[model samples]
Target: MTQTHPSPAADTGPGQWNPRLWGLLLVLAGNMLIDALEVSVAVVALPSIATDLSLPLTDVQWVMTGFAVGFGALLLFGARMVSLLGRRRVYLAALLGFAAASVLSAFAQEPGLLIATRLVKGFCAALTAPTGLAIISTAFPQGRARSRAVSVYTLFGAGGFTAGLLLSGWLTEHTWRLALAFPAPIVLLLFALGLRLIPNENSTTAGTPPTGHRSYDIAGALTFTLALLTLVYGITALPEHGLGHPLAAGPLAAAVLLLGLFTLIERTVSHPLVSLRPLRSGALVRSALGAACLNGSYLGMLFVLTYQMQTVAGWSPLKTALALVPAAAPPAIAALASGRLVARFGAPRLIAAGAACAFTGYLLQLRPSWPLDYPGRLLPTLLLVGAGFVLSFAALNMQATSQLPPAERGAGSGLYQTAVQLAAVVAVALVAALLAGAEHAAGPAAATSAGRPALTLVAVLGGLGLLTALTALARPTTPTPSVPRT
Candidate 1:
């Protein structure tokens, strides 16, 4: 197979990092931080929102689910849009849309409207998050420079959740609306800077004209989105309504069929939204799976812990957020050193080690005793989980995109992020279902028991991630064959 090299403008030589490039990276990483912040900011605020809106816990969880669904469902379509519309256009538009959605969320009175705003913001995030990574993948040259850039980019993302928790804790004390509205001005500022910093795709592609003739895969997009929505809906309903119930059974059945149809559509489409070619890469597949497990388990565990601290222990939002700081802070600090760690230990080793640490952390939290020990029990678990992300998150992102060709980087990023978001959706739904079931069976007095199942589920997910990484580590490396001199 003949190889294609990046344009000279795209691939900077060693030690050639310029000021403009650094500025562009910060812009991209800033957007990434905001996107991640959106996911976790509402978490600490959920109890406040539930009380304010007079909604049940299950219903209020939709704020988080709505965003995940919107982000996950449209990611492939967003990738297609990146290829169709220029990255600069899509990115700027998405930023504007994100700011608008955040503003709307602040003023929303009805539950449906608030959820709608979250969904729209999530859709905007779907476009920006992957596009930012694609930009980074292309803007930085391969090897050390790209690896370091990815670390910084992912570092902001890793820290964003922690930042959101702290911010939401303070903001929710004054008003939950502020938690929802806070990203608007920041995103607008990013839009202003992005307009000047982001390069035109045409300019960077060595003068290749945009492909206007290629048809968009509308069928694939619709099927995939519908499938994901239904799947999440079904999972969310499973514990409340048994599988026999129409709400649980119907959507689950439809999701399976829709997924099959989506597969067929991708096989037949001339310009498929997701090309199967990149999916064939083992490194990409492992990265996606590892990322999914990491995100799913971590978010699911957070959902349970938030409720445990607030409802069971009667801890205030700010207090709960402070206690959980161990889980969120270490990743940021550790990510700064991850590029070097990956260079030394390799991504697969880091992935496996990270997963093991997280798995142990989750195991420690399982079947916890009532009085809620922070330093002995929760602190260690949180620290291990944080360390897990510190070791694996950047490695996962780097591995996923580094192996793909430049042309497929956008799709690869979208696919990797889609896995992450969808996994969170499913995991959160599953944990919510389990908690609801435990509550229904034993009532509110059994809250401690309710969390046990959820914690066990999180540990199971971490174990699965560990196994996947170990498999990757166990795979034998194929030696490159040397060419004979003519």
Candidate 2:
């Protein structure tokens, strides 16, 4: 086994534009754009897609969830494909698949087909997403160079989400198809340029091809997928169904059973897709949970504010996204400065401060109204949330990814990305559940009265995120698998 330690600034060698790190940066930024497009572009288009397909809210939700499901499920296999095939082969394959999926999604005649294609695209994205980071991880050593690379990689990924908001609202107004297809051409261009930018190191088999490849655990995969699928679906359905209703109970129970079985199989499997031991590292586990918590607040806040700006306040999509400018831009600024701050203050102190600021920001947003003032209300919360997300995003990735050995990078990264997506899935559903519950209790206009509760939720989640940072503050010198423990 190749003992991989964090060497961010390794000799990336010649033949690959040794001096042209800019090219690699473009490739990475493009990768972020691809992923960001998946989420952000769809938000503004949701109302449109829902209308065109005549799909109910439940069914329409799947359009995005399908992609997330594919993305999360295939992450484990994605890295291995890179390990088995080669970096370039896997990446190009993923890009081509994503492109095809985009075109198909663009031209779909019905919702099911469109969603199916999106799912396929998500799978391709899963394969490609980590490869981009792995390429950087290998290209740069673990010192300042790697640190900068990690910072840039994460910063772009964070900023890309915000950029998606601007582009989504604008593009969907004209044609939703273009929103999907727009990036495909750009990705192809990057694919062509990326061929020379990075070395073709065969990551799959370091030496000779390893024989007797273990068969994938389809049972575990099915059960785990079904479990999460049912649980999330059930939660999302609760707004319509009463809590005691069997409609929610049946699927939720099935999810529990299936997920339980998944654990049992993973423990006994030859090559487990998810390793249980990583959760043993208290530091990593806490950090992973913290990442999830921060996102629960961040994503939920985004959804609420977006809706408030448009549906309640009667702002246009463009105007709604424009309202996000204050919140969106600061993360870019923070992204640039966070690396230095992390170096000086470390992840712990920064995480705490960020969380505190985020808490204060959300509290300020407790009573949002139609006017949606940017300077007084919007700007402060946006600044706080942006700062918190920037700090937490980089720190979480570093804590999760840095603790692993070289061989485990693929699986570890897969787990990390999966958790992030799962966080989004849960945030929307869970936060909405809470909001609806509170709204039901407080009459129709709950967002106005329950701003404090919503803000409180964000603050509490931020506090949990802070706790995760404190746990990881010591930076333990061991492999911490980035997945849930049994």
On lDDT, the leading prediction is: 1
Give the best candidate by TM-score: 1
Error of 2 at 105 (Å): 2.6
TM-score of each: 0.89, 0.82
lDDT of 1 by residue, 1-486 (tens): 933323333545674677767878888999999998887798888888988999765677788888998899888887677777778789999999999999999998999899889888889988898788777766666666776677778778878988999999899889999999999998999888887778776546323325756577888888987887788778778778899999999999999999999999999877777766788778888999999999999998888888888877788889988988898898877766766677667788788989999999999998557878888889999999998998898778778877777897767876888899889888888887787778788886776687888888999999999999999888874222221111
Clashes of each: 0, 12
lDDT of each: 0.83, 0.66
Clashing pairs for predicted structure model 1, backbone only: none
Model 1 / residue 248 / CA error / Å: 1.6
After superposing candidate 1 on the true structure, give the runs of residues whose Cα lies further than 4 Å from its correct spot.
1-26, 136-152, 205-209, 401-410, 478-486
